[model samples]
Target: MLPLFPITLAAAALFAPAVAGAAEPQARALQPLMAAEVAAGAPGVTAYVDDGHRVWQGAAGVADVRTGRRLRPTDRFRAGSNTKSMVSTVVLQLVGEHRLALTDTVARRLGPVLPYANRVTVRNLLNHTSGIPDNATPPAVELFKGDPFRRWRPEELVALVADLPQEFPAGSAWNYSNTNYTLLGMMVERSTGHTLAQEVERRILRPLGLRDSSMPLHEPTPSGSFARGYSLDYDDEYNQIPETLRDVTAHDSSGYFAAGNLVTTEADLARFFRALLSGRLLSPALLAEMKTTVPTSYGPGIRYGLGLFFFDDTPCGTLIGHGGGMPGYENQFASTPDGRHQVGIMRNYEEAPDAVTEAQGTLWSKAMELACAA
Candidate 1:
């Protein structure tokens, strides 16, 4: 999980077959477009796109700076809060099964594990209106820096900020909090007779055949053709604090848990989004509920749904999905509601200059536009 100031993975089993398109030919324009970002001094990058018929994957820069390993599209990443979307999906599945309800209060579900549980509904946790403060506090990060491999239990994550004041009254305002999803993760485990990872695997991963995607509940770092993530100081606005780079690829992932402890490749991530938006994951009514929107502090026009983000003004006609990163890796992905177009971007470093970040966003937007048109 890229740090809430310092804090804190998706989809299905239907269309997880071989690639339909030639990657290089499909990404001709996109290749150089992303290459320019690498030229602009960003770290190694990997990406994937699906335009219904064909899929394209591309990469630039080194996955391992020490060895100068070229980043590959198949490499896995520690996708941070993007894990919220999956956790929320499992919760909604439970709801569909009559095992859980959106209106069920935390107090009703977790039974007073939190002070405001009675007032915070399951919907609140999914939509970030729970008013619960985040647990990925500055101190936890400090502890992480001291011992990057320290294991964390789900309960310990919530306890970190449990005593703090509530962010707001339940269902009153919107604030992104990692703790909400952590509770939902706990709820998933308790409601199902299995761990959160097992439930996700049973429901989403295995069915979708997302071989490259995993909930590494125990692994500290990724293996295989994985890109190494690095860290640097960033200002409140997330602009780079120059000259503060640190290798941050190794760390225990339990702190992120369901909040965002996914390890997946760009193609696998894009495939899940494609299946999800194409109406392969859930019932129509539940999918609609997932896309239900509430205003977010990201900006006046920006909005969030239950574990899903609404990019209403995007190039691909209101693409809906999520993005996540922690110290070493960042990922952003979205697809049109009908799943006609999709894109997944992977980055190996954080806190670049504002221009670089904006440029990356623009290029990403263009990639989606190109993918849609292709």
Candidate 2:
């Protein structure tokens, strides 16, 4: 029999800090939202809400089941596509510096290596209309299966999609291709002579003082405290793999790179959303440009903004934010139009079908209702 060990609580305590100034009224009101998320079967969750002056943060469930650890507010989790917002911020900073223009074609920066580089502009890549084939397609799956732990260079990863036929004519349509941002990552390096992580740090992280956020490239799973991810069980006859548990620390950040390779805590994410909505990262004009929408087939009433998603609210009001998922992680960060109130949630297990997405939308709606009432 396998030996059983009690999970450590020290890590949990170290990561979660006491709620600085949570008010009784607000904390009681947030109970429904937390209960809904927990009923959805999430192993762990962290939520942060900022209503102008004071910030309210809460956590529920477990971060590491094997260690019997509970989720903490400060525990870091994969941000998945939330990284795009950060990347876009850096790109916009370069524009502010006059180092690169949104109109510049990628080929001007990356040269002959990228197949559609000549046709796609920097703006197209940022908005996901470049029509570049997504690197996360079958070819990328094969590469990962063969060498899940290999550290990949940006160029080598770009080359994988460089020769693939364009998904559509450049700038003619929209598609959520990871390749666009992978190329954007390379372009950032080429244009600024700095890696994506370094550029993000200098332009956004440091300026915002987001101390807990990091762009770990091929590093081990996040240090200090974090949730352990699990895959659901499957039957062999059905070609289903058994539910397995593993330390997510060994996963390669290279595969995500600029597109989805960020790790951060809920408070850090709330800060990012708040700063972005407040126009701290971009000029007012640029922020307006970033919020403009382009039609896409992904969903009815769904549109793509520059590095953000535009969703029409029902009876409440319009909201903007992004959602991301990996094998074992799902996250959402959203805020109101005026940036007065923001909600961020991260969960460890991805096994729940559409639960995370549904919970996110529900949470956003609840937040909007609460904010508008106040």
Candidate 3:
């Protein structure tokens, strides 16, 4: 199933054959698959597709369930953990500049942010091998449910789990934790004396000509045109509350800061993925480092590289991107290893039922099948 992977990205290009500008017929087939997600209980869905040559976009369902306005390809989203890939890009860029080294420990950059900082290297954090414990557990979710609008700072997020025990010794095993990225975000500011947003803007957004993308760090909802987000409200006990489907479009997400708060459109995300995997965003040697992966606990046969994920055994082969989700939105994007075919899907609702999740998975597979078609 993982026919091409656990191999170098250079060899991967040989398998996928430089994907860009999908065929028109294959591209047009996505609109209906998007509609099927709405029929399965999603408030809305939007997507983007690109082969090296042409770009296509489609959407179905309503942006606002109450107002019944149609979702559009141009709508913005809180691109969740996808922010990790961008932040990882900057960290690697710093590595290429000789300003930062993967071997550098967190304590070297920010003195003892965690009890075990000295032992945790920058590379460990990037690949989720830092042994940092995640604080965003069910109980923490309960805390936020009490005051969904309560404002939080990055310091508070770090402090929330500082005393917790490590998952394992650094580099001994793999566990995904938002705390790793949050610290790296802090290190970026400490190293460059610029906000994470500024670095992302100058180094990534501006350079790639991605005008529709912006990192609104502390803001709850994205500015300009964005789908009003909604979620199936549940208690900390995982019980569906009364009137479960509620609008969480403005919940304060400062806690998600570097880990999940970047906002952009489907089209912008598609371009970012294309440019990144095509080696435009990172130097060849550094890009190879970004793609060097290890197995993860998240799923079977799947692997995680520094900031990206290798989704093994998919219809389109291994997809190299990330997925971000919070209370009210879900964003997933990926591409062929060669950057020849890129796809992104953004929807307004989050935490759907199993039936719906399965349907969404089907939607993704079908879309990739079309995307990888000859």
Candidate 4:
């Protein structure tokens, strides 16, 4: 049976606190930050910022249009690849203890189960230069869509990707493969003799006192307060897909595994990012290693370090973060160099206008400028 927290629906009501009573400037600034995506056709969005001392959160649109439930800042949503950052933290902690080496080959740990295991190393997986084919690519998509609720084992998911040809020779270049982190998840399990969820709870979540974050494997509802996810359904003509409530509980956690399978709130996510960047989660050396960059062409200047991306914006300079997308959700969390400021944003519908990313970039730039000014 699923372990459901007994918090009442009234407790969930705590999220809709007196927004009307908020200060005028904050309320005014929040309007564009929350509605920009939806104005571009996104169904809903929630955003939060942590300015080293206090937090600001705002929400727009509906969480469940079918039920007329409004979006809330406290709502929980599947964090997608943002899960990789958290998993990398646990792996680095293991590295700190000498339980594993960054250069350790997978063959030594996974044995005959993995065909090309001999070629990939722990560092390769963390930085996503593994060359391993992403299991979430093709045939696996069939399995996922056919039985969205299916619980997949790590080996099963890895085999799906392993059955495919390598994209490049190991470490020759960078390719973001879900397979890399799924294998890393297994590596964490084997090294610690505990499930990935348990290690996450023991090493990061519990220690940071993140009460609202959860690594739900097969369970649908979270233990405490959370948000409902929504998807857009389109017709033959290219138009805004009508927003429909989604059951994310059926999302195959096994497919995402360590790569992208955790649900959290904005406040908890901000806390985690702050802790990670502040040296509370990793040693200085490991954290430094985690922040170093590899080349990419996706944005102004894109680079991948261990499990996070470093974005170099003309106005904001360098910021560390990870962006994630699933069927009906998109999320981003970024922190400045000193870890004194951070921003997190989540949208319910997958298809938002290209302007959304630009707007996000603009918001980050403005937020940093304001923070630095203060």
Candidate that would win on lDDT = 3
Question: Candidates 2 and 3: which is better by lDDT?
Answer: 3
Compose the digit string of candidate 3's lDDT tens values, residues 1-374.
00111111111111111112335664456655665666666767776666545666777776766555667778887788999999999999999988899999988988877898899999999999999997565323732366655676767778888898888999999999999988888888888999888999999999988888888855656788788776666666767553245677776676676787688887778778888988999999999999999889877868999999999887777889999987678888999898888877777777655545676777777667766764
lDDT of each: 0.75, 0.70, 0.76, 0.71
Candidate numbers, best lDDT first, in rank order: 3, 1, 4, 2
Kindly report which residue stretches of model 4 are placed more than 4 angstroms away from their true locations once superposed.
1-21, 24-26, 138-144, 233-249, 297-300, 351-373
Error of 2 at 306 (Å): 1.3
* Model 2: per-residue Cα lDDT over 1-374, one tens digit each: 11222222212222322343455444566556655665555556666766655567777667766655777778888888999988988888788888888899988888877656788898999999998878764323432234556677777777888787888888788999887788888878988888899999888888889888899987756776776654332243323232233334356678888988888887787778778989888999888878988987787777888898876753336667887776557787777767776667676755344554476557656654554454
Residue-level lDDT for 132 in candidate 1: 91
TM-score of each: 0.88, 0.85, 0.88, 0.85
Stretches of candidate 3 off by over 4 Å are 1-24, 51-53, 138-144, 236-238
- Model 2: how far is 234 from its true place, Å? 7.0
Residue 346's lDDT within candidate 3 is 78
Please report, as a residue range, the 10-residue window in candidate 2 with the lowest summed lDDT.
Answer: 1-10
* lDDT of candidate 4 over 62-145, digit per residue (tens): 565445477777888878889999999999999999998899999987885567788889999999888887886542243223
Residues 205-242, model 1: lDDT tens digits? 99999988889876767777677776565555545556
Scored against the true structure, residue 270 in model 2 reaches a CA lDDT of 73
Candidate 2 C-alpha error for residue 315, in Å: 5.9
Q: TM-score of model 1 relative to the true fold?
A: 0.88
